[model samples]
Target: MDLREYSVFDIMGPVMIGPSSSHTAGAARLAKIARQIAGDDVKEVQFILYDSFANTYKGHGTDKALVAGIIGIDPDDERLSHSFELAKEQNISFSFVKSDKDASHPNTVRMVIKNKSGDVIEVLGSSIGGGNVVLKEINGMSVEFTGEYETLITKHIDKPGIIAMVTKVLSEHMINIAFMRVYRQLKGDMAIMVIESDQTIPEDVRIRIEHIDGIEKAIVVDSINKA
Candidate 1:
């Protein structure tokens, strides 16, 4: 098996404000990814923290960190100390529930967020140490993407040539796709496509994708949080 070498910074730590990178920093990033999926109109959020996060989140400021992220603050920001007050000021209601499920990652966090229009979405993520995170699930579909590239998530009905049509739009925009993956519930039912690209996907590309014949939802996210 090939081994991935750890950088010095990876071995040491990331510049962050937290008691534990896994509990606090990782949790913050997890919430940040969830916020991206839920969009800015979020009104209420429910966090389902599992294992270590559930047991010691309060003590380690993991709860505050998650709230800070939902408000668009990074883990390294000083405002993380006042995340609770900030959340209250925004009127974003939230609840934390703990559960231990077999076959689930210990550092997993599942978030259910609701918007003003009563639109609700669920996202699951895991913090993989050193402030890095992975987007695990979206709206009950199993998908995965690292927060390392300009990512696009699309939900559509499974059909032939849909992938080609989507990529063609991106190509027209001159966007280079670094990675692409498709996941489906069944052969001909719903499907989720994840694309991580070298450059940000333009708003027009997203709209065009949404306008496609079979596409249902098209979400464009920047790993740099530019969106």
Candidate 2:
């Protein structure tokens, strides 16, 4: 076999120090992205790793890397060397579970997060390759994003004119949304909107969004470059 002709995976194969950069590093990045989506002041986090991730998470540092990432640590940070202990020091509660499901990518992970105010969020993501990731779902919404944008994620009851209301608020603040995606469950009763913007949303706008009717929760995630 011409190793050079093959993708990096073919050359490197499965790794143990980490489950190839695509899985472990990508998992770390996904965790970081989830934290970004959850915003700061996070208190508790639950991680669900699927398929191959479940089989070798420990050896790959997927567990440690994940906890470390959630705490706002970089994947390559040596502090990850003691992430389990560091997480304890930081008082960031974290746990992990393994699941067998065809619903998610083989390298997928789902994050259930809670902030200090008790606001809860659930995000699903996948580690694609080359330490890159795509946020595949949020709050049960099937969406595709690179997880790098400064974003606002809102969960609410689906109703008429909610998008207009939210967008109007953002527009009034001069925040330009680069893209918007919505996910709704069962006749649009419960919904989630993921808004990617060119820049961060102001605190005042965020506060205003919280007051919007039908909005259950609003979270502002700074870009990973900023985090």
lDDT digits (tens) for residues 15-46 of candidate 2 = 32354687667777788878867776678999
What is each predicted model's overall lDDT from 0 to 1? 0.85, 0.79
Cα lDDT, model 1, residue 146 = 79
Cand. 2 TM to true fold = 0.79
**For candidate 1, lDDT tens digit of each residue in 1-227?**
74998778676757789688878887887787778777667789998888888888889898999888888788788898898898999999888998877425778888999987899999998877767788889989988887779889888999999999999999989999999999998999999999999997788889999999999988877674442
Error of 1 at 69 (Å): 1.5
lDDT of 2 at 111: 91
List the pairs of residues colliding in candidate 1: none
Best by lDDT: 1
The superposed Cα distance between candidate 2 and the true structure at residue 7, in angstroms, equals 20
lDDT comparing candidate 1 with the true structure: 0.85
Provide the lDDT at 200 for model 2. 81
